[model samples]
Target: MARFTHSNKHTYTGTLLLLSCLALIGAALIADFMLASSSYSPAYLSIASKWAREKSGFIVVPNLNASKVGQKESMAVKDKAERIPERSLSATFADLPAPELEWEQMPSAPVPRLDGAAIQIKNLFYVFAGYGTLDYVHSHVDVYNFSDNKWVDRFDMPKEMAHSHLGVVSDGRYIYVVSGQYGPQCRGPTARTFVLDTKMRKWRSMPPLPAPRYSPATQLWRGRLHVMGGSKENRHTPGLEHWSIAVKDGKALEKEWRTEISIPRGGPHRACIVIKDRLFVIGGQEGDFMAKPGSPIFKCSRRHEVVYADVYMLDEEMKWKTLPPMPKPNSHIECAWVIVNNSIIITGGTTEKHPVTKRMILVGEVFQFHLDSLTWSVIGKLPYRVKTTLTGFWDGWLYFTSGQRDRGPDNPQPRKVIGEMWRTKLHL
Candidate 1:
């Protein structure tokens, strides 16, 4: 209320204006620092919203609880982003490729044939009678020495020996050749059995079976030679009979084959293996080649075949039990077991016919059956589809020789029998 002067009034107004400008500048700098520290903070968002509304002539309200929720959401997003790479890394490691298995070609067999028998005795591999070209049957044995990697010797089989479809097995020193097709081309089977002494290279007659079977499954188990499941004399008829004969020193201790528990499913071309007193028979067919009636030459009759994937196990109690079947139907894989890592591996056999073409499809996948889990998995593949492949496992390598290969679309005949041998390092 003092007397006013013009100069004093101007000076007072100037001082108030300068102080207001300094205060506004300080507030703007503080707001910039808060936004840089946490742009998603509710307070900063509220200020931005307020500025936007003022510029756009709209209403805005600050939500206090949104600040806490925004912080939690931001932390969750950051944590998820950090964990994504760890999961990806773990998946990458799990999907690493299986060890590469490369197959190497070995020396070919002395003679190319089909429906033959093979057995491994230490370093020597013996190839027995088989069907040659044009309905001819071979009655000879070819011996291959793995150490020398060559066909070491060839010897004539006994005159009474069956030429094809013989059930053959070895006991480290002696080879037991059982009943099979006596001659060739849909001919009848023989009940006579014989044993070959590998060391002496001599064949001796054994007791005969009650009846003849074509391509029977034979194995030596617990001092007894077990024979079971083949086509009967009718050829197309499935034989369920199981027989065994006691033997020692390559001679049958019994005068005749003794009857035993019959197999669950039976025909021929099944793979049989004995593991720790358990007998496992896997994959076979219901029908086989038949001889046409009144045909002097016993020409094969056109027939329908029912391939199966049934698996059975003979337990210690002498009882048959069912097991998990193969992933697909497989047959003509008489001796295809490679025991590795408590699992049995079977390769190269005939599977189901092609659905479209209704033609036989040979197997190429290497199948693994885990003994403990009783599960099946496809581990790898063969170089090509094949059947009747004689397989042997030695020194961590799998060897296969003598099989009928797949002749492509041009070949009218389904089988192109080969003598080529192959080996590959087994990696499971």
Candidate 2:
């Protein structure tokens, strides 16, 4: 019985030795495959390293293509870092390196008004007639002194001068005030043209327009005062008439305005600018608020206003050519231009109405029109949305004051007309 038991034990020991040898041979095959194959996965390396550590008590380092793996990982990180999110219409301007762009509020004007015209001569900003509260029209001039940062002077305008919508321009010393609405709301325009001598602070009559116009785009170009586009007598119809007259020393050389080529798209509240003798008209609306036919012409309604972004330029060849339209349509932005870095910067006007609310949408963006490139870009924004904002540029600063401000950020409807002035440094 003892001899039979000893034989069975010997057979069992031999079987165990055979199984151990086969397991070692299988592990050797797996290790060889992991080291030899270039396409071996990370999982294979992990399993091989685990087996080697458990059996031999030594770590197995993977022979991965370190350079290629590093390069691929680095490229993935770079791509993620360089990705830029898409911007929206209301996005803030960020083309240039951002500077300190906070707006500083200045002293408010004496009286709040809208549709006013302002021009800077030296250090003085002359604010002309505008529409006041409750159908009242301001027929006076408020002069602001930059040195003192205060409203320094106030003077009465000519009784014959129109109260609002006057096309005003300055030639250092002389200010040409052209045709405009003579009275309050819905009043017919006047053909009487006047020039203000800043040195003398005196008013002189110039050759009147062939017919009166409302908010005509007026600018001085090569010794000639050019006037083009405005609303007609009905206050709703657009007038495409263009006229000019030779002028030296604020007085027209001719007795009558010579008719010239009409503007392509005629409307009111457009900015007229002359850069390098090139005439450009931009941003106006076709229809204006119309007066309801009644005993009093003060009652009005904005039933048919259509703002547009169309831009037109009159070249030296005496032909009008269409330029690229604005980033968005704008109106009630007459006389809003500040020349900086070979570009014209316009700010704050009425854009198209809100799609959902059907209310007027005021513009808060600072638009830059590059003369060299003829391109439009939203460079910055205002503190809030506004329309008819009086603009001035002085000593590396852009100033704006006196306009109708929007209700709130959530509400685009216009709320109140303000005379508060604000300015920001132009980091050119």
Tens digit of per-residue lDDT, candidate 1, span 36-115: 43423443343334223322232333333333433343354655655332112111110111223688999999888788
Which regions of candidate 2 are displaced past 4 Å? 1-100
Q: Name the lDDT of candidate 1.
A: 0.76
Worst 10 residues of 2 by lDDT: 86-95
TM-score of 2: 0.76
lDDT of 2 at 137: 85
Q: Rate the local accuracy (lDDT) of all candidates.
A: 0.76, 0.79
Q: Write the per-residue lDDT of candidate 2 for residues 1-428, one digit (tens) a residue.
A: 12436658877777777988998999866655543453334433433443233322224444344223323432445555332211111211111111235899999999999888999998899999887864788989999988778899999999999988889888899999999998887788899999999999999998889988999999999899989899998788999999999999978999888889989888899988888889889989898877777737657666677788778998779999988777667888886777788889998898766433456778787888889988776667788888999998888888999989887765667889888999898875
Candidate 1 wrongly placed segments (more than 4 Å): 1-100, 409-413
Name the best candidate (by TM-score). 2
